[model samples]
Target: MTIGKTPPRGETIYWVNGKHPWVSISDMVEYGTILTTKEKVSVNAEKLFGDITPTGTLLMSFKLTVGRTAILSIEAYHNEAIISIYPFIDNEYSARNYLFYILPIIANLGDSKDAIKGKTLNSKSLYNLLTPLPPLKEQKRIVAKIEELFDKLK
Candidate 1:
């Protein structure tokens, strides 16, 4: 949603109190997994915020904390501090798992800028962020390898 069109806090009546996962930067962790969320909104709030971002959408924190990333296991809504990135349609190379792994690196590029309040990667900066685009097969292989390595670490 646009900055000018942000829903006011007084609209909490639309919040269903745990019906829809509402994510914030505070919910992000370094492990790249969004296991749970403390906030939720009602269906009305979901409609107001466009739509619930689908499960598996990659969420990245760009404001204060800068490079935290996570994959949404449940469909959810997120505040402005988090940007929900959906895989590109018709692009075989657009793997959500692969993007989850690489987005933190892409987010780090925006960390060079300084904001008066805190480090911020504005919408324009986020829109302009570049990412690697390996072939679909290669992306799947990379994701598998990463998972295997992570399992080994566990």
Candidate 2:
């Protein structure tokens, strides 16, 4: 969907209260990597806004659980309010590894406590989050180094 041409908020198909996965903001946690699923599973495409390919779309709890980002280690459906950011990487490119490295950066940024109901993260404020970008090559190197060190620590 083009930014300027995107449908108005009222016209867009958004996830409502009932359709969302009701998890506590504190329960939502971030991990360096998610365990891979052995069996293949089909998921609803509507839960995700953009591409649904595993490792392609990065899922983050953008609401009250801000900074809890996770890469789709396996092809699974996400709930509404989950901040799904998928870089338009073709089948040849994977952003999952990079997302793992960047998750820390996002988590450290802090979450907004002033929610509409004092229980959820304000989506409007979530969008204004500042994400630092590094060169592609540098990102790759950072991912590799982090992976190596984490492996040793584990």
Give candidates' CA RMSD values in order: 3.3, 7.7
Predicted candidate 2 versus true structure: per-residue lDDT over 109-129, tens digit per residue: 645666574334455555565
- What are the Cα lDDT values of the candidates? 0.72, 0.48
Of candidate 1, the 10-residue stretch with the lowest lDDT total is 1-10
In candidate 1, residue 5 scores what lDDT? 20
- After TM-score superposition, the amount by which residue 109's alpha carbon in candidate 1 deviates from its true location, in angstroms, is 1.6
What is the lDDT, from 0 to 100, of the residue 12 in candidate 2? Answer: 31
Which residues of candidate 2, in runs, are more than 4 Å off? 1-29, 32-55, 89-96, 107-111, 115-120
Q: Write the per-residue lDDT of candidate 1 for residues 50-133, one digit (tens) a residue.
A: 767777677877777886778778877888778777676525434877877877787788634687767878777877787787
Q: Each prediction's TM-score against the native?
A: 0.79, 0.56
The candidate that wins on lDDT is: 1
Model 1 segments beyond 4 Å from truth? Answer: 1-6, 16-18, 89-94
**In every candidate, how many clashes are there?**
1, 2
